[model samples]
Target: MRIVSVRTWALAVFGIVASYASLYWVQANTVDGITPPLVGNLPSIVIQGIGVAVMVYVVAQLGLRQPIGRQWAWLTAGSASFWIGSIVWAYYEVVLEQPVPFPGLPDLFYLALYPLAAIGLFSAVSAFGKLFDTRVPLALAAAVSAVATGAVYFAVFRTIAADAQLSAIEKIISFFYPLGDIWLLLFPAAALALTAGQLRGGRLAWPWWIVVLGYLMVAAADVMFTVGTWDDTYQSGSIIDTGWWLGFSAVAVAASLMLDVQRPRDTGEVAS
Candidate 1:
């Protein structure tokens, strides 16, 4: 069990490092002095996929020995899965298809990915929500927000199909996309806060606050970029976009390390 835990941690660390390296390569090799839109996005997705795989392995290791470990393992693995889906969607939407390109078969796949990611994220929140008494409300809010966002996005899609010049769908999709992100933000923040509280109680685990902080930073950067470029082409050169991805990748690595460190000991003890 100890060996397995160590192996998982090693894999997580490797995944983090590898992801960052790939991202760095993408940034360094910008085409025509402009960061290729897809370049920035694709590496992140690949890295995240690697991170998710590592997390699943780690979770499996923990679950083998402890019952409660199974719950935490699932939560982490589930979140990773969602992250992977989001990464894939981003790759297809932002990287693969862009610049007046209508979403094709890939778009269908991309759209499907969002809901799956949403479900995985929700499941993770539910599994760990007890940490915060507000889990129920947060979960409900997230669900409602997701549905609302989806409906608005769908409406825009319909309008776009009906009349290419109609900006109503674009307007609606733009207005509510951030609202959808808000749901993503809430539950993770709640979970981190709960984990922080546990740390305060003398839990010797890797601080959940680290992951929380990283996630919040990423979310904030995303919001800023979304608003900043709302009226312009979604370019990747802005300090906010590039810097955000770099910071996000770094934080993800840190979070993976923290998870590795927090892996429960053989005594079956876990941070509450």
Candidate 2:
């Protein structure tokens, strides 16, 4: 770790502790007179606020100095977008004290995160070196996984399109979130592919996988929300919320560790 990383790490630790404590309180305290909004939903806003701020600090502290910097910039944008989504969602739950609508303003921001993150990730990794070495079959597996993810997206979309209760716009918007998240999983599924084989997986090297873990957390929550809500069975403050909280925390922590992550470029083999 770089000596300058102390502050960044401090902020990341705060986010983690805050999120964990908030989540622990929500889940462990089961008692009388407990509403889901107060006990389950409100804390998310607090977590998102801290999580996004930590990431913003990380990006701002580092600035856009290198390819990794550019990648983190986009990642920060992704986290900020999710933070906005959480705020909009909380406005409905905490401020208005009503059921948040599906396919609302929050959904728009939430859907944008995947593309922003994907573009940054692909751009940086591809610039570092060959993202997928044709010499290895892993690239082929990445291809297959991408295809499968796309197939699942279309299948789910078709089902949504057939639903009579939803409007035409709702049909498309409703599926976009889970669709984007399912795409998120593709990153970790082909983790080695993203390591940019040309650098001997040294471009992002270590923290990139942690970032992928963040994607996986959010993506797993996407699966939980999609399936659980199909029958209107999803509950607030459930284990699903932990995925998002932890996901955001992971991103902040990952960005803070960029100092060590970028060290490989100085001495080890690096692509120009």
Candidate 3:
């Protein structure tokens, strides 16, 4: 018991350190023309990479200690894709001394995160049974996505890309942000639906809530970044970055808590 308690404490401290360190590094290294050493992109790399590692560790070491399941595997892969995108962006920002290209490797990884994460969340909810059936909840999720996406497009994207000088590629890239945000917003909605009537709740409920919050935070951070980029006012170390730090940290926390949560059913069990 003491050993487990100490290990949990260690994870908490590590998470706090990693989250704040990324924020501090971003703030310190955002100069336009001046280039820092490897430190320039180190913060982004470390934050995302550590986030991936922590999520996997939590799912593997703490999450039931059974063989790593498809749900956790998908989530881990999603984080890894984001980390890879971060590294690619860092290379573009630091080594090349240029902006990351539109529709590039970074974008590929970033885009991949959505479907993978969605699948993972879907799988997680499916474990709780018919709470998230295909008909009502999915229709509701789609309706929510449509409304939210429409509002965001009108309010944010329209204003940002209204310039005549913007090209086809630019418009596409600008659209990607909102699309991704909308897709991510589905997780929490599904999670809420899944746990709606259950009073006592499964062991997995807390972790699911944490993951849901993390996804929502990611969407919120993306929104801020989109708006900030449109206005040309987003800064590297700004408070906007906190969304990601907190979001990823929440995910890590979920992973760590997985062991204490109820074990997820196998794929076959969930499908039935």
Candidate 4:
């Protein structure tokens, strides 16, 4: 099957984001009390559902027998976990007409997504283990990680950590999210940096970069969600959610383009 042009996918992604944003506005601004129950809960479910479908389809197309195939397979599972978490989120917000419980079942699935995807990423990076020159690449990664960790700590963890009203469990749950994103972010970044030489100006680079960008979107959305919730301004279908829709859509498109990124083009050293 022929994949569509990147521009086409980009347009489609933008269209989805626009649709989500529109739905969110409708949900937020109810007329005659019509939208608060139904429309309020649809955006996250719809966007995440599409992402999981794309991920599952991509893995199936790539075949599970191969190594990178297995990598995306796990990634698909991670996406599914997040999708399920959204369902639980919508269930409380729309179905039950109650506040969704924090540090709850949904939190379990949401937290699970990071480590699961991290496993997939770790698998992919492990494939290129021999190519790694531990000195320079490792040092660079560590330095960059230090900066990222510090930024996230100040921007996210610090607030959650200092929340006097939260229970010990609540604080722990809140802390888990940004830390999870840190885990998820490290993989694609490391893969890009480590494989840059082999991928030098190659077709494979873009998809990986897109994957990284998708996670950055997810990470950003997570931070925004945390702040919003901290300030009691967050709702499921808010504008901040556009980042998640865009992130998931971008990852799906990247997965579709993985025909090139599943492996390098010319280099034979990095096995699978």
- For each candidate, what TM-score against the reference? 0.53, 0.76, 0.76, 0.83
Best by TM-score: 4
Cα RMSDs, all models: 7.8, 5.4, 6.2, 5.3
Show the lowest summed lDDT stretch of 10 residues, model 2.
263-272
TM-score result, candidate 3: 0.76
Residue 204 CA displacement from its true place in model 2, Å: 3.0
Compose the digit string of candidate 2's lDDT tens values, residues 46-131: 77767677667657756687666777788788888888888787778878988777767888888878887777766664564454
Residue-wise lDDT of candidate 3 within 1-272, one digit each (tens)?
11123333455566678767766765577577343546545655666677788777656653443333567777788878877887787777778877666557787887788778767666655664454444554566677778888888788788767877667776777677658757654544454444643534544455666776776677777788777765666544466766776676666666655544433322111111
lDDT per prediction? 0.47, 0.66, 0.63, 0.70
Worst 10 residues of 1 by lDDT: 101-110
lDDT of 4 at 254: 70
Q: Rank by TM-score, highest first.
A: 4, 2, 3, 1
How does model 4 score by TM-score?
0.83
Clashing pairs in 4: none
lDDT tens digits by residue: candidate 4, 1-272: 22345433654565376656766576557765455745666777776787778678768867889987898888788878988998988888777888888768888888888888888877766766666543564466667666877998887777778879878887776666766776565545555545654654545556666777777788788888777777777776666677777777777767766743553342122222
lDDT of residue 104 for candidate 3: 74
Local distance difference test, candidate 1: 0.47
How far is 89's C-alpha from truth in model 4 (Å)? 0.8
In candidate 3, the residue pairs with backbone N, CA or C atoms under 3 Å apart (3 or more residues apart, or in different chains) clash, namely 62-259
Reference-based lDDT, residue 159, model 3: 76
